[model samples]
Target chain A: MTRRIRVLIAKVGMDGHDRGAKVIARALRDAGMEVIYSGLFQSPESTARMAVQEDVDLVGVSILSGAHMTLLPPIRQELDRLGGGEILLVAGGTIPPDDAAALKAQGVAEVFTPGHSLEAIVRWIEAQVAAARGQAAW
Target chain B: MQPDREPRPGTAAARPADPGAEVEAARRAYEEALARYREALAQSPEREGLFTTLSGLPVEPLYTPSQPDPDYLAKLGFPGEYPFTRGIHATMYRGRLWTIRQFAGFGTASETNARFKYLLEQGQTGLSVAFDMPTLLGYDSDHPRSLGEVGREGVAIDSLEDMETLFEGIPLDQVSTSMTINGPAAILWAMYLVTAEKQGVSLARLRGTIQNDILKEYMAQKEWIFPPEPSVKLVVDTIEFGSQHVPQWNPISISGYHIREAGSTAVQELAFTLANGFHYVEACLQRGLAIDQFAPRLSFFFNSHLDFFEEIAKFRAARRIWARAMRERYGAQDPRSWRLRFHTQTAGCSLTAQQPEVNLIRTAYQALAAVLGGTQSLHTNALDEVYCLPTEHAATLAVRTQQVLAYEIGVVNSADPLGGSYLVEALTDQLEAEAEKYFRQIEALGGVIAGIESGFFQKEIAEAAYRYQREVEAGRRIVVGVNAFRQEEDRPPEIFRIRPEVEADQIARLRRLRARRDQGAVTGALAQLRQAARGGANLMPYLMEAARCYATVGEIADTLREVYGEYQERAVI
Candidate 1:
């Protein structure tokens, strides 16, 4: 049997608040994905470094500490430099819609907000993984 | 004292004589009450805008004999008596003030130790250590999972060596310590024990608390190293171990603080936290330990949130409810078992980053509520906590806030000053009823673990949080800096910035430890741990061994993951 999609869930910067990140991690795990949850107060460099080393298919960054204005873009830059730009990057937290759009433009595949259902997040991940695999096949 | 004469609202006498007249009578009574309230409100327009609380229990224009007569002794007995709603102790802060513990830790162990010493010298009565991300998640400083996260957020203790340096000068016997760690709490606790032993203090002599409440970790906190079943087993092991070894130590502080911070309302926090405590009690019962043996040492931690009366009522109700349940349902014989001793931390989530200094005021209010609610210990959040780590100056002021309340403020002179007040009593009764309703719902759902799996608790918290946020946005609730009084001003002067090199130093120390520790001994112990994990044996003893052998938190967690696999979050949303 093929292996399940492996994901690493992380919280970057000074956000000790981990409710949203944890819920998403649990949801992803329930969707039959292998998950490694690196707990709170992580820096972008550290998160990116862990993602690369863990060899996860996706890195889910949940930041609510408002440091995302400085943290996320550098993590995206680091992932690209590490040659895992192909790896899926998902962001979630208290991001405003406009900022979320900007983050997606900067290469975050998707952003899950507070009201987003777990089913929606799981389905989105499955679709993203499927789409990536399809592109690779082509 | 006198016989009942007239009927009050919601009572049978207040209703109409005939069944058919009920709705009309109710409507007329409501209209009359509204008219009377409007007439009163015309004089003071400012009173019209104020809400009673998040619970939607309306405040009366004036409470008189017409108001409901509440039971004083039944609802709130004398302090230190059965149904301890007044206060845990009769004297309270008048005799001894609440322990002013500043949760301080960041950077290297030496740095945290220095901070601890500094805070102690500044008249802080107790120490509360905050571990970094890696240590909390059971990762070593040098783990691939650690990276630039080592000591930047909080102190990183990889082994006994780090633990030793963390408490080098502090006498564990003289002052109590509280570690806000959950995932690897048992290991960290063992490290503390080993440190105390090295310092010539017996394990029995040490007094401290470990946030070993793994149920909360799964339900709200989400910092578990193992999955729920095993995680709870580990917690029970700590409870069992502490009961036998360290009588003075609080092995698990079943925390409602995190649940409240996770956005649960006061009642939800109370109900859910109490339910979690019951679940832990049941787990210990199954472990073949007597209730009174470990129950006295079991403590609780609550968040004193922005809702003043709601928070106070929640605390009062929690104590009464726990005492009743422990005595009646659980048949716990000991008076200590009946007492619900808790530590209160002012809600960190209520602090806003918009106007940082405003957090000090918010924290002070919450701290006052905690004091009125009668917490055994308290930690006031620093002003800059909403934005960054608390600088020495900010933390000192936070500690001083507690001291001022303890000394200058005469709040502690009398126990439960608001105990007999009609408003507070009514609110407490309402809160107790609401919590009871929740208890029934959770019971129907098969208790806390089942409620967690079904996402019942999470849904309630989310809905309440959403409603509260809406209230804030719509001006129903006012946070001075967040929704009102909006302007950028001079920021709080004392904000501490963690030096990035702290992570480098941690990693370097981790490397040296790995190189120096006997590789053969480490491997042998790890092999034994792997065998034990697969054998359905208790993981705590093996974890204790690992901690004794100076195994990094990550190595043990990794090995457990290899054996038991990791948890999968089922999408109840």
Candidate 2:
């Protein structure tokens, strides 16, 4: 069988809102992805380091406390700095479309906000992993 | 400022009517009614949908006067009496309407101060302060950890000056303020007390509550600066100190707001919150404090969710449970200690980002339930909350929703009007029983702290959250604007924006204060605070001294951080 799609979910900064992060993490695990949740209060540097160390194929960060404008770039930069540039990064939270668009432009593969289903997120992650893995045969 | 104990209304409603005689007569009548109902159901079979509450608890098609309560009067009791099931006050809202406390804060202290003034002018009965994540986490605006987070979410108060500005012209004695800060609650609370002192207001005259319930922070909010043992000790210190000096102030508000927001069912919210509150009571008792003294000031905060009747039932159950436990178990003599007064905030998780206008209706109904459920104070969520903090327009509408509910809706005309309703009574009984089951389970886990240590609460909340997500995904839960009624164009609502300059302005202000304040005084006060923290002495007085000397939140927190190491939480999912 193909290697299980590995993903890491992170909640960075002083934001303690983890309901979304935990839900998404479990959804991925149920979707047959090997998932690592970065728990609460992860720094950008530490989150990126975890993704690289875990050798995950995708990293999803939830920034509900509205610090995406300040925290997202560093998380992206640190992932690239730590030789995890290949790891596709996605974000989620109560982020508005304007900031979501800016974050997407800054290399976030996708942005999921409230009202987005866990299935939609799982599907997005699955498609990305399959495409990145050359659409490997089942 | 204490509520008068006279004039109870719901209490005089009716006695339970002898259960033995009534149950037999009602049973025969109920049987006939049930048979007829089944015959009608067989012909037209009701609607093709699940008959369940928002929390997924099964609801019967009809409720009848069955066996009812074995000892109903003792179990529910009268309003403002033991087991205050109907309501805490005799007249409830008829005596005094629930405080319309809008939880508002964003941008710089000055900007938030303006919003506060505007809200007070708009007939908001109380003030609630929402601090930014940095302030909530005990970091200064200039701290590296506070970058991008300074005043972005809520007001940032790095020093006494920020707090002084935040409450500039507002007299501390006149207005009741509730601060939503847990991890650094002691520091923020001290800042508030010092602000009152600067205004020359006696601490005894202070009427406010600090969300200093740290156990809930560890279990649900995940915003702890210190480990559980010391964090709770700090909370007890505040309670003991508050009871002695700030007698009118509630030092801690045992909260299930975040617990419900984190996806637990209403029953879990009630049980876990009461368990946490009981733990605090036990902790204070261990510290040699009288239960009557501190428990009277002990308050609660609950979330009013989408299920109107269910949320109402939860609140009713909460009151009944707390009253019984406080009087029977904890031996609190003061009726004030037994009364469970809570401030309810409508569920933010229930609001949708899609078709944001729909959230107003949802919030209005939730507010109505809170009023019917006998909330002492309420904070209605704004329509734009799903995206960000409420804009001025959104915030005004939120307050108006409460105003409408209070003034126009006529919900306050009767206290616990649903008290005798068969369905509500059944739900209250069912919820109270369910909460008792959870209480036993939590006790088996060695109480709240041990439950947190074992990740029991985290796991339970996570499972519920994931299940809720799946329910929405499967279309089992038809959330308007999300699953069922999606308008093709789901435009974003007007969002309140904290200026990009807020962080910079706050930092500059902090630097300016640091340059002018007595650096030696700051050092001396923080040292004394550390010594008190090292010993068993209450840290509140020393903290007040530090706040008096203008010691920054970060400095005082870091000083204690030296002695009580920071807590690192592991991922449970």
Measured by TM-score, the strongest candidate is 2
Angstrom error of the Cα, residue B32, model 2: value is 36
lDDT of 2 by residue, A1-138 (tens): 689999999999999999988988888898888989888888999999999999999999999898998888888899999998888999999898998899888988898988888877788888888888784343
What's the distance in Å from true for residue B548, model 2? 1.1
**Per-residue alpha-carbon lDDT of candidate 2 for residues B157-224, written as tens digits (9 for 90 to 100):** 99889899999999999999999989888888898998998999999999999999898888898888
Per-residue error at B275 for model 2, in Å?
0.1
Alpha carbon lDDT at B65, candidate 2 = 35
Each model's chain A TM-score: 0.94, 0.94
Tell how far residue A34 is off in model 2, in angstroms. Answer: 0.5
Every model's TM-score: 0.77, 0.90
Q: Is the docking of candidate 1 incorrect, acceptable, medium or high quality?
A: incorrect
Give residue B464's lDDT in candidate 2 (0 to 100). 91
Model 1, A18-98: lDDT tens per residue? 666666676677679999988665678888888898888889988764445467888889988987787898888756556
lDDT of 1 by residue, B97-123 (tens): 688888888989999999999998988
- Native-contact fraction for each model? 0.03, 0.91
**Cα lDDT, all candidates:** 0.78, 0.86
